[model samples]
Target: MSDSTAIFDTLKAAIAAEEPVALATVVEGPGTGAKLLLHIDQTAGSLGNPDLDRVVSRDIAGELAAGRTGVRHYGPNGEAREEAVSVFIESFAPPPQMIIFGAVDFTAALVRVAKVLGYRVTVCDARPVFATTQRFPGADVVAVKWPNDLLDEIGHSLGQRDAVCVLTHDNKFDVPAVTGALATGVGYIGVMGSRKTHDNRTVRLREAGVTDEQLAKLMSPIGLDIGARTPEETAVSICAEIIALRTGRDAPTLTAGVGPIHR
Candidate 1:
């Protein structure tokens, strides 16, 4: 097979296994189809020159961390300027996780939406039956374990790209889940509940030693105020809120405003 084909196969396997990898393509240059595949500690395939492969692979890993995919310029010998080559570094970082700490109807809906958003979703609950894979087919992992324990095991993996959604409205589950999630540096922690429920949770969480700064990290009541009553609609609102939070955009109805749909 060709070098590009080999790189494509490697990327496909890494994505299927949920392993982080990146592909660097020579989009503009003498070697247009030339490609390089890189993982954190390993390199498979190459970009013709050994020096070019080493340099491009290192830069591609950085792009993977930020979950970015775009074109970049590089010289034929991988030097700055001169515009001898242009590489398109496509990062397939391990899919960002959406750990839902509940296996309810809302959890199923949220799992579906999370999958649609390309998240490696996990449905965790203390009850084995409720947290079964049958209930959440879309989830990457259906974990029957305590929220805190699960977080303790994999919390370190939760980074800026990941999200923790405490859909277990029950204080017993949500309190610990929220506390554990906050302990990690996860980017988004959304708690599902009504206004009153959230108020009670605030008191409980504070009593449990959640600090003011930590509390600010939470998107309590979970979703945007989209007047969504059904589980599916609520799931959409919640996912939309997560996207809005990441983009720092005001979550307003597009119908109510007029401008370019995207910026």
Candidate 2:
């Protein structure tokens, strides 16, 4: 019935459920051995001071989002640049997620690649006939719903470790998909299209109320500039771009250059 017991139970549940969670221990601080269980939905225990808990709580968010673990120092009252407290944070992050909108040939290939890359892949399409588990066996989920509707349902769970790829190629689907993905905190948003298609889709997206700032998050003609000519090759390029973005690495993404996408 104690708070520490409840926090321990919660931590166990999170780990068992494969949810993203972190534990912060006051390893070298005024309240040594104090523990705080942190996850996207829960926070428990404290570090002997309300201010310290509040500051460490905020810092743990960034660590959990990025799946990072290490020690962070703070003043006893959570002041900056002080080593009055040393909280060692340990993060347990779930597999990163990828949601691909479209049930085209590329979708299957992308699903396969994403799975191999340890992503919990979901394939979404408004057309039920095309969006079936039979087609995308590698995907963890095959959602048959409109792009915006699906994103609205699961967008809250998408974080910096997650990605959204719009490969519908149709303006009707691509615009909504890109817009909805922009509304989320997903780290990567890639849309598949030719150079001409990308330009035309941009106009449609703008008309749909997508702002220039939001457009900046999109990687149209989605994928690395690896001269991919096949669906599997394009999938590799797309996944490579996703990894590059998450790691903040410079990559040869197609968006960097203009012209025919094939080139």
Candidate 3:
């Protein structure tokens, strides 16, 4: 088969397997229509020049990691801040992940809400009986394991598009879960509790070696100040908070308040 045909086939296979990949096409440049297929650990095809391919490949990797797609400009020889070449980098990333670290009532509601938002949900808890497929029917993964252990295994995979929610509300579970998640690149790390519980959890997280900078990343008493009392409503509030955080919007979060979650 031809080189283009081979690249197209590989791209198709990667997308079919739900793997992270990016296709960079020189949309407006000397080598228009020239394509480069970028994989996590490998690459195929090239946008005409070796230097151009190298630079675009590096960019494609970053875009894929962020689960983003867009156009970028570069000089013909891969020089930065130049616009000689316009490559359209299209990222084919798998669904973003949402790992809920509890099997509580809020966890079930969050699972359903996350599914609606197109997140690949995983319900994890140390108790096997609580973390069952039957309890979380829509979850892609139901893991009966310690929160820290689970994060240790898959934490590296978490990216800016993913989320980690700690809903255990117990210091024994929340401390380790928050500490583990703080080490990951996951964009959103939310913990559920009241203001008092949030203060206590914060102390424990600091004791567990979570730096103040990392502690700032945690959205304790997690969710928007939307008067969300029920689990389903709370799920919406949490997901909304995640969106607000990602977009850097000005939303009233539970962390911003001084008193109770609800009046």
Alpha-carbon shift of residue 28 in model 2 (angstroms) = 11
- Candidate 1 global CA lDDT score: 0.85
For residues 1-263, what per-residue lDDT tens digits would candidate 2 score against the true structure? 39888888888898878888999999996889998888775689988899998999988888987789999999999999999899999998888899999999999999998988989999999998999999998899999999999988999999888999999999989988998899899999999999989999999999999988888889988999999989999999999998898788999999988788775
Predicted model with the maximum TM-score: 1
- TM for every model, in the order presented, reads 0.90, 0.75, 0.81
Candidate 3: 10-residue stretch with minimal lDDT: 253-262
Model 1 residue 211 lDDT? 93
Models sorted by lDDT, best on top: 3, 2, 1
TM-score of 2: 0.75
Ranking by TM-score: 1, 3, 2
Winner on TM-score (1 vs 2): 1
Encode model 1's per-residue lDDT on 1-263: one tens digit a residue. 57567667878888888898888888887878777888667787777888788788888888987789998877778887667888999887777899999999999999888999989899999998798988787788999999999999999989988999998999999999999999898999989886777879999999999999888788887877777788899899889988998898988632233333223
Across 1-263, the per-residue lDDT of candidate 3 in tens digits comes to 39889889989898877788889999997999999998767889889899988888899999987778899999999899999999999999888899999899999999999999989999999999899999999999999999999999999999888999999999988988888888888999999998889988888887888888898888988999999989999999999999999899999998887787889
The collision pairs in model 1 are: none
